[model samples]
Each structure stands twice: as C-alpha cells, then as structure tokens.
Target chain A: MSFINYASREINLKIVYYGPGLCGKTTNLQYIYQRTAPEAKGKMISLATETERTLFFDFLPLSLGEIKGFKTRFHLYTVPGQVFYDASRKLILKGVDGVVFVADSQADRLDANVESLENLRDNLEEYGYQLEKLPYVIQYNKRDLPNVTPVEELSRLLNPGKVPEFSACAPKGEGVFDTLKAVAKLMLISLKKNEK
Target chain B: MLGSQSSLVLFDEEFSNITSILEKLLVEANAKALFLVDKDGQLISSTGETDQMDTTSLASLTAGNIAATGGLAKLLGEKEFSVLFHEGEKDNLHLSLVASRVILVVIFDQRSSLGLVRLRVRKWNEELEKIFNSLEKKAKEKGAGNQSFFAEITDEDIDNLFR
Candidate 1:
C-alpha cells in the first residue's frame, strides 16, 4: 500500500522481499544496501536470531529520484524465512504496496518454494488481499548453484503468468537491481504513474 | 460546524473506505496476508485471502510488538516507533503503525521486496491519517464518549489475552 502525498508532493512506497529460508532475500537487500549511493539510501537494519537468520525483519529506506515533482521514496523490508515464524510473517504483510518473490532454484527445495507460495496466499487472504492481482515479480535466485533447476522449468512453476522474471546470483550482485526495477515498474503501472 | 453525532458517521465512513483501498493494496503488493488492527490488536478490517487467520493472536502479538518496540524507541530517544520489520530464515513479518489508531501487519514470500512494503506503508499511512483525523473530529463533535463503529471491545478484551 503506497500513498501519494499531495501535501508534501512525495510518493512513499513500501516493498517487501519475501521467500523461503536461505532463499537469498536478505542477501539481495544486503547487495543493494552495499551498492546503493549513500545519498540515496538509509541504514540497512536486520533483526535476526543468533544463527543470523532474520528473527523478525530487515529494513532499508531508499530514494528513487523524482517523478514529475514528487520524490518517490521506497522502503525495503525482508521477513525471517524460517517456517516456525509464521506468526511474525503475518505481522509483517499488513499494508504492503508491492512484492518481489525470490524463488530458490535448487531442485530439492522445489517443495519449499511451493509451500512458501501457499503460505503467501493464505496470509494474503487473511489480510484481505488476493495474490494473483498484486504488482509482483519473480527472481529465480542462486542460479550459480550446481544443482539449480532450469530457468524455464522454474519460470513455469513459479511465475506461470509470465509477470517479469529474473535469473539472479544475489551474492555476486547479478540481477539484483533488475528484479527491483521490474517490480518498481509494475508498481508504477498499478498506480498509473509515469516511471521516474 | 458539524456537531458530534455526525462526526462518528464520518469516522465509520473513513474506516470503510480505507478497507476498500487496502483490498487494492493486497493485490498490488502480492502479499500473502495483511491486517489492520487497532492499538488493542482488534481486527478492524482485512483485504487479502486469510485462510485460517487467528485474529485473536494476531491482534495480541501486534499490540505487544508495537508496545515493546515503542518502549525501546522511547528509551533510545527516537521520539517515535513508526515501524518494525522481522526477517527470519524462512518467513518474514512487517509491522507498521497506522496513524496510532491501528497497526498494519503484512506477511509475504521471500520474492517480495522490503522497499515495496515500506512504500506501501507510507501510502497507507497517508490515507489512514485522513481517516483517523476525520474520525477524531467526529468524536470531538459528538463529545468523544463511544465513537467506535467497529466493535464493542471491552478492557477485558485486551487484558484477557495478556493474563
């Protein structure tokens, strides 16, 4: 859920990076946080368990220049990917504006991917949202892994609708911003705003 | 000037409209679930497809998190605790305070982006401020006694869960 504040002439948007455990959601944000220009980004906050898994969530506030006169600011969030944290997951998706799904490309984790998507749907329903219609993108991450699934196969299963998909090796910074740009474009399309 | 009785009507209307706006948001964000609960964590409205959402525990946890974080923020002299994000090894939780009247909770897949979630929260906050202001104004007009159009929640409703 994003607001175009006419008073301040600013458009604030919230985007959450979501996926299963160890699926590279946190890595993607870390990559972006490191690569982003200091003037355009904020501190990357990660609240995690002792094991370093995101305990609750992570946040990165960013500025994406201006469209017309409104400064389009984006807030980035990542949820703990562990399954038992289902309660925390529900708490995070309250008033979301856009989403980027980072699907793990490992063949054995296929079931995890599917189950995560199901959880996403169930949680969205709980919040009075429908999964099919949101401004979303899919990134088949960890493509560098030897046991990764074929991109085509992953695409068909994860993003059958063909809503923009990216092949990513997040740790190396491959396809990170490309995924972000695609989702941001999708978000702008939903608002009928010209992309800045 | 509109008197008090009419203000309550405005508040209810604003809340109703915000729910519709939220429905569009759930779709836009591709969220798995979303919730708008009051400070007490009572469910006011939800838009996405929640299959077995336990609003009871959802409200309780959300309020607890906000209170806890709010306390931490004040301790750190941050002035306000606007939002809290939890990224786990498997799933993630994003919680943002909705104009102090309510809390917005969202659950999403690892495929979603934090920036998008925060952007939407700002947008939701913009609209929510208006809704709360209208409702507050309506309450002022009506003498501020009982303004909630949603439910007849008691103090026990909030205290029972903690006990």
Candidate 2:
C-alpha cells in the first residue's frame, strides 16, 4: 500500500515484480539494486533458498527524488515464482500499488508465462483487485536469449490490454530502467486518478 | 483488500500524541527504540535512539516477520498472533499488533528485560489502539477532503521526479 505521511513529508509506494519460476524476476531487482545510486537505495533483502532461488520474496527500497514537497519512496518486491509458491505469492500481493509482470520470452517458457499471468489475475481477484484496473505493465524478459518468442506473439498473448510493455534482458540491465520508469510513471498517474 | 491508495493522513496533533506515547514507552521500558509500523511495512513514527539503525529495512522486515507469523496463527485456528519476541545476543525485538492494522515494534538491549518491555507495551497498547482507531475513522470521513490537500499536485510535478 502507498502511505502518504504528511507529517513526515514522505510518500511510500509498493511495487511487485512477478513472473513464473526462473523467469528473471530476482535478476530485475538485483540489476536495479546495482545501478541505483547508493544514497537512493536501501539494502536489498532476498529471502531465498540455498540454491539462490527466491524462497519467499526479494525487497529493495528505492527513493526516486521528491515530488512537490514529499519524498517519493518505492518499495520493490518480487514473489517466489515457482508454482508451489503460490501461497507466498499471494501474501506478497497485499497492499501492492503497482505490478510489473516479467514474462519469460523464451518460446519453451510460454506455457509457464501464461499460467503465471492467469495466477496473477486469480490472486489479485482474491484481494478484490482487478488486474485491469491496477497500475500494471509487462516486461518480455530474456530477450537476449536465442529461441525467444517473437515480440508480436508475446504481446498478442500477454499484452491484450496493451499496457506499457518493454523487451528486457535483465542481467545486462537492458530496458531495466525503462520498465521501472514506465511503471513508476503509471503508478503516479494512477495515484492522481485515485485521488479524484 | 485495504489497497495502497487508502490515504493515511497523520495530522500534526495525532503525530505529536503518538510521539509522546512512544517517548514514554522508551523511558519506562528502558528500551533502545520504539517504532510504529503499518501492517504494510511503512514506518509511521519512531522514538528513542535510532540514528545508527536502518529503520526502513527494519520496518519492512518486521512487517514481513509478523505476516509470516500471522499466517502461522491462522493455520493453527487463531485469528492472529498478537505478539512476538526474538532475543539476540545483545539486543532483542518485541512486535505486537495494534488495532489489527498497525504494528508496534520495540527494540532493546540488555539494559531492559523482556518482562519490563512486555509490561510497558501492555499498558500502552490500549492508548495506541484508541489513537489509531480515530485516525482510521478520520481518514474515512475526510477521504475526499484529504484528496484535495494533494490536489495541487500536477502531472508536471510527477514527471519532474523522473527527470
């Protein structure tokens, strides 16, 4: 949830990165953590397993300068993308302000991507939120890899609503900031609309 | 759903009242710090010595810890876990739920005992609950009014942040 603390002159917003298992959700967060200026970011916390796979979630708090007089803080979180981790995913969605769905672009992972997207819709519904109404975006990740699905096909399947979409190779930081900026912008716009 | 868009308006009066209560707890419990965190991990207020601590991370992690514990509580047929204590080698943490919407976190060193911390927290919980209850009520009643406070913000202001 976004907390507007007038007393503190701060605005805190929560954004979640979600996708299927091994789809580079954590990589997106790690890349942002590395590139963000030290003063602008907090320690990145990853609740992961011995194998480095996200076990629960990954959290990175970032400050994106000030708006008006309030400092804008964004808490970025990633859910465990494995199928069995559905319960953990549901918990992470609580109070989410925006969502970036990082879909695996490899052709073989298409099923996993679709399944995960459907799961996102269901879980969001459980919380009384409609994915269509929320500040949302899609990232076609792993674009650098061979055998990746065509962007047209990916969009046809995943970007039906045609929300802001980006082709990202997270490990190398390509489109990382673009994706972040897009969602952050959309989230702020949504906040303004919500206010009205 | 209690979505993030719910405007949490903390007036100066409410902030001062919460701060005083926290200061009192810090003094009576002989603790290092006391933090009021929303269930979503936003730090509402804090008192005591915390210049060296990363309260942002602390608030997020504490809320995550409490959420995990609350999930466990549900599995065990409990509505929620009211309090949790973790003792470390030199420091300890006490987490409790206030009004089921916010969390009260107390950190201490060997200077204070768990018994004393718990005792002080119990005495202060009722007051904090009343404060938060009214805060929530005011937010609901003044929802549109609060929006007007930020109505002055324009798209240009938001875009300026990205620049």
Return the top candidate by lDDT. Answer: 2
Clashing pairs in 2: A1-A95, A1-B4
For model 2, residues A1-196, the per-residue Cα lDDT tens digits are: 6888778789899999999999999999999999989999999999999999999899999999998788999999999999998877888888888999999999999999999999999999887889999899999999999999999999999999999999999999999989999999888888877777
Scoring each candidate complex against the real one, what DockQ results?
A: 0.03, 0.63
lDDT of 1: 0.71
Query: How good is the docking of model 1, by CAPRI class?
Result: incorrect
**Candidate with best DockQ:** 2
**Model 1, C-alpha of B116: deviation from truth (Å):** 38
lDDT per residue, candidate 1, A1-196, as tens digits?
5544333455566687889999999999999999988988866777788888998787777777766555666767787788998877766665566888889999999989988988888987776777777778889999999998999998888887788889999999999998988787666555543211
